[model samples]
Target chain A: MYQLTTVTKRYQRGKQTINALEGVDLTIATGDQLVVQGPTGGGKSTLLQMLGALDRPTAGSVSIDGTDLARLSEAKLTKVRAATIGFVFQSFNLIPTLSAQENVETALVPLGVKPAARRKRAAEALQLVGLGDRLRHLPSELSGGQQQRVAIARALVKEPKVLLADEPTGNLDEDTRDEIMGLLAGLWKDRGLTFVLVTHDSSIARRAPRLAVINNGRLKVTERTP
Target chain B: MFFTYLRRELRRRRKAALVVALGLALGIGLVITVSSVSTGMRDAQDEVLHSLYGVGTDLTVAKEAKAEEGGSAPQRFKIEGREDGEKASETDDRLMPLGGFDNLDDSVVDKVAAQDGVATAVGALALNDIKFTGDFKPGEMKKEEGKPGSGGGPRVGGGGADIETETFTVMGVDVSALSVGPLSSSKISKGANFAATDTEALKAVVDSAYAKDKDLAVGDKVTIKGKKFEVAGIATADTGASTSNVYIPLAQAQKLADADMKGKVSKVYVKADSSDAIPAVKKAISENVDGATVTSAADLAEQVSGNLSTASNLATNIGKWLSIAVLVAAFLLAGLLTMSAVSRRVREFGTLKAVGWRSGRVVRQVMGEAFANGVLGGALGIGLGLAGAWIVSTVAPTLTATTGGEQPGGPGQGGGPGGGGIAQQLGEGAQQSVDIALKAPVTLSVIVLAVVLAAAGGIIAGCFGGWRAARLRPADALRRVE
Candidate 1:
């Protein structure tokens, strides 16, 4: 569970103080699926960064399980991110040099898992993502949909409590985007994970049970039926 | 996983890695070559110094001879049979007190030996034996007709003379302390060295070259100053120049040179307790012993000139600085290139951090790649260094070193007619210039130094790249890439 209060993020761009986020309050329960939707430069990614513990808000309290992430040291925040959060980028940011299995295994490395077990778990995760036969393929060898699946496998391999994805389907066509969304939904349901996704596609946002629409650093949440 | 990542990364950037390695290799190879050549220079200098003062001698004490002090004097030979009305007469003349140096009392040796840091002090006399054998005919001098503007003088008519001069160096050794003089550097090639009992036995040691020239051997007799002496041994010098043509007992040399030279010596060779003690001993000898001029091996090394000295100076000055400059440039290049590599991989590192890899881990990955490059460079550099040193030793020309005769106004300079002009012509036939073959020997220490330098270069480059990686914030990195 995450509790964010009065979350404000401000940055400078050529002597202009742009408010990336302002007075935003949010709560995400365990096993909740939240989809954040916004246009370009609309603070959707900034909110997701706060939730992922990848950046500290300028003036706010972001709490996970009653622990304020904003008050934690950088090293402690890193540990929290390593153990509890997994991130997926729009470009399917898999290591270009690593194969499918090795890219997934990197998520388990920080946990000090032995190499043999890490390999076994990574192979299983790849198999779950419908890329069991593509374990040795580089990121470039995979198509857009297949690369998204590899990214999903890497994000889920660590078995984190939360998954944060930024524009996860922005780089794919309609057919591939629907296929990736189906895989993510199935995995989220099976594992009962808290999944937060940032996207600008209304088609993808329509499927979320809760939608947080952000514009110019302000947010509004609405409930809907999937 | 770390090694696997490092290996893959290095393979992907093989060309850049090779460039960095080759740069480092060039610097390291030059260092090794210059170091080995410097070692060779030192060895050659030691060889030359050993020829001058022998191996055991640390310093030599001698008093400079003045030109007008009878150090060199014209010799008068009595031509007999002139009163018997003989037209032609053959004369043989032998001159002593050779090499033209004033003698010092034997007490100076005792004084030097008693000084602090002095291990042993022994004295030897350096002499030159010149024999003149020729025919001389007596002729009458008549009054010469004077030209209108010329001076009138008596001139000899129908007189002719033919003369032949043979000269050789002789060193007198004190058999009791023969371990620190000219004879100390020579090895007995035939027969044996001077024994204690041969101090007054009229025994002599002939140099190998001198013996070969005169067809003399052990047990044969040679005439010196009208005295026949038995040859006890034939000796060959160790390096540089031969010591002397002959070695005889100090007592015999004194008797032949002068009747009043019973307890006098021309040169004193002093050995110190240790190399570090040499300077102090030299100072003490100079301050306490009157009129003594001390010459150490270091002093003689400074006087060396010609190709060997020039090469040695170049190796120490230009060669050393050139290696340093190349090494510094290589290190800067490596550091800059490594940092640039880290900059190019910012997104990859940021992704790793988001997936829970610590900053230390990211830095280590960068450092590991840099270190691998360093190791590769080190291996290649060692091979190149060995090859360079080999080529130097094989292809370098022979170097010649000449010692300076800078003791001005000293012996034999102002001798009247028939006197040799330079001391080199009289003093031990000292070959002022010596030829030495240049050798570049790569010792174990030089190899170890090369390894250390290579490792240091790698570590320094790694530090440069790792610092860049460790300071990167994942969010900032990811945002920059986006």
Candidate 2:
């Protein structure tokens, strides 16, 4: 569970202080799926960054399970991200040189998982992502959709409590995007993870149980049935 | 995982790695070659000094020849059975002490030997044998110029006369103390060495070149100042040139020299107790022994000239600076290239960091990659350095070293019958030189230095790249919106 109290994030662009996020309060319980929608440069990603523990708010506190994340050390925040949060990027940011299996295995490395167990778990995760036969394929050798599947596998392999994704299908075709969304929806429903996704697509937001619309560093939320 | 990532990254950027490695290799190869060649130059210089000063002799003591009043006197030849206006043929051989070095009292040896740090001192007399044969007719006497000792006597001129001259050097040795003088660097190529008891036995050691020139061997008789002495041995100098043509007992040489040289020696060879004692010993001798100039091996080395000296200077000066500059450039090049490599992998590093990789871990990965490149470069550099040294040792030209000596006598000075004056002969006597083939010997220390430099180069490049990787914020991954 996450709680944000009047979180405000600011950026210094030259001499101008740009407000990336204004005073905003929000709450998310465990297994809740939230979709954030906005136009480009609308502070959608900034809010997600604060929620992911990737950046700190200028004012107020972001607490996960009553532990204030804004007050934790950089190292502790990294531990939180490693053990409790997983992130999927828009570009399917798989290491270009690593094979599919090796790419998935990197998430387990910081967890101190033994090599044998790490390898076995990585293979099992790839199998769950329907990429078991493509384990040795590099990102360049895989299709765009297949690469995104590998990224998804890398994220979920650690079994984190939270999954933060930014534009998960922004670079894909409609068919590929729907396929990846379906896979993510099924995994989220089965795993009961606290999922926060940022996107500009209204169709993806329509499937969420709750939607948050952010524009010019301000936010508004509404509850809806999927 | 670290090794696997390092190996894969290195493989992906093998071209960059090779460029860095080759740059380092060039610097390392030049360093090794220059070092080896410098060692060769030192060895050659030692050989030259040993040939001049002889083995076991750390220093030498000699007095510079002082100028005589009204210049040197002209040579006079006495011809028996000579009639006025009639042609006469005569031959004369004058065995006199060499002119450049004046005689020092025999007690100077004892004075030098008694100095602190002086192990022992032995005296040697250097002489020149001038044999002249000519046919001439006595001409009318004329009043000479205002030079001292120019007697208006029968001047041999105006007649068909030809004079032939032959000159060879001779060194008188202390038979009992031969281990510290010119003979120490020579080996008896044929015949036996001088026995300790042959101090005044009228026996002589002949140089191989002189012996070969005169068709003389051991058991053959050599005449000096009309006195015949049996040749006891033929000595071959370890270096290219021998110190003298013949060696006789010191007492016998004093007997044959002028009356003033009766109980004197031209040179005193001194051996110090240790190399570190040479400066003190030289100082002691210079302070105590009046009119004596002390010369150490280091002083002699400074006088060495020709290709060996030039090569030594080049190796130490230009070669050293060039290697240093190239090494610095190589290090900088490697650092910049590694930093550039890290810059290109920013997205990848940021992704890793966002996936819960600590900044320390990311830095280690960059460092590992750079270090691997460095190690690979080091191995290749060693191979290149060894090959360079081998090529130098095998193909370098022979280097010649000439000792600095006094200028040859000017024309019309000490005018002889038909030859240059005795002063010119003496000047030639001091100019001894030898040719040495250069050999570059690779030592363990040079290889160790190369290894250390290689590792240092790698770690330095790693630091450059790792600092950049460690500074990347994990938010940059999603912030870039790629």
**Candidate 2 displacement at residue B258 in angstroms:** 4.5
Error of 1 at A170 (Å): 3.3
Q: What is the TM-score of chain B alone in each candidate?
A: 0.87, 0.84
DockQ scores of all models, one per candidate? 0.73, 0.68
| After superposition, candidate 1 runs with Cα above 4 Å error | A132-137, A140-144, A173-175, B66-72, B87-95, B98-101, B140-157, B175-179, B186-198, B201-204, B208-222, B228-238, B258-260, B406-431
What would the per-residue lDDT of candidate 2 be over residues A83-199, giving only the tens digit for each residue?
A: 888888899889988999999999999999999998889999999989999999999999999999999999999999999889999999999999999999989989999999999
Steric clash pairs (candidate 2): none
lDDT of 1 by residue, A134-194 (tens): 9999999999999989999999998999999898899999999999989988989999999
| Range of the 10 consecutive residues with the lowest summed lDDT in candidate 2 chain B | B417-426
Q: Write the per-residue lDDT of candidate 1 for residues B133-227, one digit (tens) a residue.
A: 77776677777675765467887676556777676666788898878987877789999889987778789998887888889999999788888
Instruction: Give the per-residue lDDT of model 2 (tens digit) for B117-138.
Output: 9998999887777777888666
Native-vs-model 2 lDDT? 0.84
